[model samples]
Target: MVAERTSRYNFTPGPVPFVVSGGEGVFLHTTDGRKVLDGAGGAIVANIGYGRPEIAEAAKQALTGMGYVAPLWPTENRLRLIERILDRWVPAAAGEAGLTRCFLVSGGSESVDTAMRVARQYQVAKGRTERWRVAGRATSYHGATIATLSVANHDRRRQPFGPMLADHPKIDPISTEAAIKDLEAANPETLAAVILEPIVGSSGAALISESDYWSTVRQFCTDHDILLIADEVMTAYGRTGTRMGFEHFGPAPDVLVGGKGLGGGYAAIGAVLAKEFVAEALAEVGDSIMFFTFSGLEVSVAIADRVLQILEDEDLVNRAAKMGAVLRARLEEEFADHPHVGDIRGLGLMQGLELVKDREAGTTFGGALTPAIIGEAFKRDCWIYPAGSARVPDGMMFGPAFIISESEIDQLVSITRESIDAAVAGLQS
Candidate 1:
């Protein structure tokens, strides 16, 4: 028998414990033949779950019709998807999630890249060209590309590329009051826009902002003439039980960047939804026409169209809402007695469990705690994302597929409880 080389792939696979081969519902099959329940949906990207026949068929049909087309030219699928998206969000929000126009891109990084360009262009169009700095929230993730990386708060993700990042202002995520103070101190005149994940995803799944906080920030941006961008790449498309995360807020964002579940992980796609005013600014004074070759191709667009239809037909968004409540309730019931499980918070399918060392004192777990818990969980064939700082406590963020059932939801909560028990027991022993 001919022997193949045993050299393995060395790329980092985020916070996952193993390589996933396939998934059905919320269960993922790893290459090592382990079927682990996907509690976090692979960074909250797979909302629809794995192995969908309809989505597969849509992609196949597009391939048969026409494989690829550039955005410089027009295509039928692109036009249809754009019309469909505008029709859905525009009427629903009464112009609150004001994205009357859609600009497609390859993925989330490209979407954020376009967002930065659009922000700077908006400033230039309004004749505030000197407003060059981009302000981003600490611990929020935009993307991995250079400009987006510059604005991104994932320390580990950005450390290697630190030298090349463009100069931008950063605000700590302590409070909206503190953010305002920092922004003012960092030359508010030069600031073009402030971007944030309506719900923080990466850093401990921190859902610290209150209901009025977003509205206050929106008003502040308006008074200061800085564009507000809602980076819904992780929280959009029913992840938060709404069409958009900003729907939970008071004022609409000037730009809404969505990608992760935009195509439901069936295709690589992202889009920037801009207000009519932002579109007009681009039309009037912006010289650069943003275009990516595979941004709005036939296959990706067809998949997107079907994904939206499925979301509506199946009423999965509502499912996310119902399941989220059950999951949260179960967590509270199961882990209420546990000393390590500090706090649990989320919206819809997006939920997080902060594991601390002591409940009475609220002391956080150190760096060693995460790997121990994650390893123990993997042995049980359960995959959950572990995040947070050593200085602070650790937490697990979970946003399972919207189509998840009550049994599966219970399983998730049970597995987490088991993982926690095993970890704690090991430490105590």
Candidate 2:
């Protein structure tokens, strides 16, 4: 007999594995002939859902004409995509006041990296040479790069690399209120920018600054001459029902970064949208380039342009809002009475479940319980995101594509409720 080897492990140290062959619409067909609903859209990137023929055709046509181009050279696809993004975010009412320039990148991580770099450079261009430290909130995820890792507050992800990245850049983890005070107290000369995810993704789907938080932060940044960078990698492209998460807030930032669904999970694309002042400051520095790559290729831009068009024409953003409300209502109705479920909250389609260990005391279920629930959920054939560090504890997040159907949403809700029960029962036993 031959030793058995499976294709893909389902995120747990288990005997069984799930091997997926293809996906269309909101359903994933496994190699074992099982079709599981994609509950979380593979970390919320598939906003337009899987297998978009329009995006495919656009990619094919662009490849046939001009497959690749250096980032330094201008291309029609890149130009059109930039215009589309600008049209969506920068309204005629503002007239180029919100975002003045765009820098293209490969993905979410690169988008964060570029924003950090641009912010740092902007400070330098303005003769604020001492301002190098970047600030981010506790538990918010930026990226995996050295600089981004410094900014992100995930202990598990940063622990191994902390020693190596400690001195690379200065990062402060502070609450919205404390951040303002600390910045005011710090050598104001040393602060470059404050980077944050408007609605926190990962780290248990934590959200900060509901209404006035953003407005207050924006005012503080403006008052102190600091740059504000909204890292919208997960929240942009209609994931949050809005075109961008910052729109939910009052004021715009000095720089805005978006990726993930920007290309609708088709092309590897990310972008940095800079305010006119930031762009003008960078321009004054005399040819200071932030990113250089071949990935500003024509094919990616063409595919991304079509993806944006589909999002607009199909009214996927509005659909996400409606479907999100339905899913949340259904979950609230089912699990609101469950003693172990502590909280369920989110914006748009980005939802979460934070389980409690002691229902009476409202104590959280951390450590083994989280992994156990995720493990059981995988066994049940649901692909929701189990996110958080040990510090946050017992978090399961869901952000299905905007194109997810009502049936898919209900299926996801049913399976999630079942999985939670299974995990709770096992714990009690």
lDDT tens digits, residues 205-253, model 1?
6455756668777887889989898898988888888888878776688
Query: Which regions in candidate 1 have their CA more than 4 angstroms from the true location?
Result: 1-7, 12-19, 30-33, 94-97, 389-393, 425-429
C-alpha displacement of 155 in model 1, angstroms? 2.3
For residue 184, what is the lDDT in candidate 2? 68
lDDT of each: 0.79, 0.77
Error of 1 at 396 (Å): 1.3
Write one digit per residue (lDDT tens) for candidate 2, span 24-105. Answer: 8877777888876777888778888887788778988898956557786778888888988887755443344558688889
- Score candidate 1 by TM-score against the native: 0.92
Clashes of each: 0, 0
**Which candidate achieves the best lDDT against the true structure?**
1
lDDT of residue 213 for candidate 1: 69
Give the per-residue Cα lDDT of candidate 2 at 232.
Answer: 91
